[model samples]
Target: MTRETSEQPPEIAEVLARWQETWPTALQLWNPYVSLREPQWCLTTAEAREAGLQDSFAMIRLRGLAVVVDLETVRKLRVENYALQVLAHEIGHHLLVPANLYDYAGLMMRVRLALAGIEDRAPLVANLYADLLINDRLQRTMGQDMASLYRHLREKGIGETRIFLWYMRIYELLWSLPRGFLSCDKSEPVLDADASLGASVLRSFARDWLDGAGRFAMLAYPYLIEDALHQQALREFAHLSDITSAGVGAELPAGMAEIPSSVFDGIVDPREEVLQNAPNHQEADSPGRAKPGSLTAIIPGSDASTGPQQRYMQPGIYVDLMRQIHPDVDEDRLIGRYYRDVVTPHLVPFPVEALGELSGDVLPEGTDPWEPGDPIEDLDWFESALLSPIVIPGVTTRRRVYAEDIAEPEKEKPYHLYVGIDCSGSMHNPRRTFSWPVCAGALVSLSALRVGARVMACLSGEPGSFMETRGFIKEENEVLRVLTSYLGTGYAFGIPRLETEHLQNAKEKTHLLIVTDDDIFSMLAAPRSDGQTNYDIAEQALRRAGGGGTLVLHARAEWRPQEAERLRQMGWVIHYVTDENALFDFAKAFANRFYRSQGNPTCKRP
Candidate 1:
């Protein structure tokens, strides 16, 4: 198992070769795509560093679809079952623990939540939980002597913290061993009765691990809540896991994504749900964002008579989880997801059943009976046949007749929705993969489409590529596709791009919505091809379209006074917020004011 060669050492390699031959027999499935490689073969020490691997050889990292292993280290430790057991554990991680990128993110989300106050060691604690689940599976189902691996690991054990000891005790209980099975102190393990219960509970829910995770974390909450305990634990285990190396070692393999995000939607903090469903639970006034002192995580399925609620999980918990899952999750996108998830239930989808926005030409789907005054063309013949028994002198199904309002005379007003979003580098959250502006843009675009309005979604990142839907169309999917895509090249939103590409070509009076930061000043400052400034182009577009507009800027008060004032003079609505999060509020308010109560998509002022 020595990592001395680019090739696997003959001695350890032989053991693994034998195991590899029978690996498929055990897994009962063949995956030609997976292969084994030595540490140097899979990735050089340098490559490992680049992938953020810890310096320790005790850890293995999966990267580039291959698991990186230092066989020599494994051989030295004389692990139980050698490559067979250890390799299986790593493969299990790929097969189950993470499953996909979103689940991988879910892994961190659940762990950080479970660790709450002792989040500094969240990754470490998470690794322990994962190992427990994996080992228990192998020992219970696969019939492997996985406990032997821990026996050797504990022999070199340095120190014990309450949480760590409690963690180990669960292992002891799982294996039917005494409490002091793997402790360095050499004294009888002073164990929490909860550990025995946790071990029992762990087995009880092994088949359904994700949901059980939230519950297990609740049990471990008291053991990890204090810094005094954490410090003492750190001091006790200094030789075991260095605090600095904890994060790096705890990292999963590079390129560990094959799963879609939709799979993790059901993954939630069980405690949060319990708290949410509490009999006395009261939602914060501003449900769009985390309000101060508004968050609490009660014990899942806790008895009401058990003293006061064991509450935790304060504000910013989700933000912390997001940041931890990946350093690059877009802040605005998270904000958008949060607001969208929160406000979506509150939003009554546009009253599509009501033919309120119907053009006087024809009727839409329905089975409502026609009255004597109903138009003959609006009668539902099929519905009338279905209800033939109730036939009467002018009784037939007809869509409730409603007259559409016109924004302007001489035109059949179908509201034109123009969304101009800043797709510049600033809109990109390197930590996260998606754009929030795109999400927010999607919400509004979808709303407009639901109400029979044409949506023109434009992604403008000045001095770079600009994308827009083909003028305005009613297809919701097409509109959503354009809004959620990202263009991370430009420096700011291109006002000229909007003028030349969107506003100038608008076929009808359009409700133009621009999403950008104060940096839009620079885009406005950029010169245009025709001698006209970007501002002039923007102003003229509003005038030409003759539809009221809104500039939703994530900028400071000092940043917007002049341009916001200028845009206001041009009959544009200026809504400023200190952060992108408030865009959701603006969106909800705008939808309520302009689209919700409307009888039709007409180019008329509210």
Candidate 2:
């Protein structure tokens, strides 16, 4: 009996108390790992909302592997007695289809690609597909009456929407139910054929669920194309959308930037698959050919594992796609990680400090026990043998410590990096577009950190605002966060940024690298608060840095002859590139020249 129609409303305490006892059987249904926590049994709808179960009686949160159920809603729906099936289905979401946050994101990513124009429908479609896989497994393999739960839900109304009918029919086919059973007898040849294709996809890709996400979405595409039908289906099946918000407040999944080429190859439409499989089917010019004007050729998903050349989604597209997956993900972190992923492949080896091989260090002063945790190279086999014929780690192993002569020169430490980039109105926002300047900055800044150098990154737009690290720091994220941020303000890199206290109090020699266009010359010429212009600040900061400076300009070499010469005279090396992409080449060459074993040498400036 429904809760309201009964003589008295069911006590929420009594419902929760009863369901609490059933939680064990629900968990045991999956034969899950012993440590899996029991589902959170919220006693009321308000409690359910707080537990992240939005519109459903039960929901799963991938962030904490949390399964929440509203006992109030369960009682209202009269499925309080079906606690095992409902809770087990929620558990199946955690253990099966889109189990963890990463695979959930992967499933959404593939579905979004398939539902290209109507991508917002992806979450609904993904939730439905996941339910199909989970419910099918529960019903057929595990002997759970998942169909009965749908039948109880089907009492409200069985809409005539093609997507809804096709969806329900799939369940009917999977459970060997009659045609009119769950779908309200709304059967048609097209609906039946499509339902058969979907059922086949569900069973075929049960083990490899992510691979079938695109195919399932493609099957639902035609039904969802009409706005009216899509909206109707959404309203009809709103209760089943347990995982629609699964990625909310979740960490951004790693390695999503690189999509495998085979992923797109697997994005086959089931209708097309059926056509090709038919005996009467005739081949086109080529089988599996992408439609004209389609992105098949452009969006090449080369696997990094198999080939050196790996393809990445555009920064803007990736950001949009990820936002759909994770609504509240930090945009700065996304952009920072994006550039990091892109530049990782191009990163050269961290410069090896060429401390000329240790000289005058032959005197063995003492021997110490060498634990197994110590480097194998440190073990002195002769001394260890003398202690015992058989060597035993930490017991018989010995390492010889030698004293070096005091006359040897101290090893040189790497110079700190001060990277300044112009985030002027002219610059594109790296969050929205691929900013080569930001990419190049990430490359160099991360390289410096890899070599154990402290770096202070600054993004400046003069006459407006600027941002930078607290001081010289080794944190890659902090440096990258600064490099990738966009300040669409003034017209140039604020030359006065060089006057920061960090540079003034530098203990080690610091290299200043500024990336900007010819517009920086305009900012440099503008007078500062003091009578001295920014030109004086640049020269003075260069002197204070003590390690010299390089100004990488994305401008024609002949564009600003006099101003460029003035900076060159201030002991600044000037490199000009007509194309912005060459900044990466410049950073690579600059790191190679200064950090290599060849010793401190000037980069060949253009």
TM-score, every prediction: 0.51, 0.80
Clashes of each: 14, 1
State the lDDT of candidate 1 residue by residue for 190-233, as single tens digits: 34455665686678667766656655655555566677876776
- Whole-model lDDT for model 2 versus the true structure? 0.81
Please give the lDDT score at residue 286 for candidate 1: 29
- Whole-model Cα lDDT of every candidate shown, in order: 0.56, 0.81
Error (Å) of candidate 1 at residue 278 is 22
Error of 2 at 28 (Å): 2.9
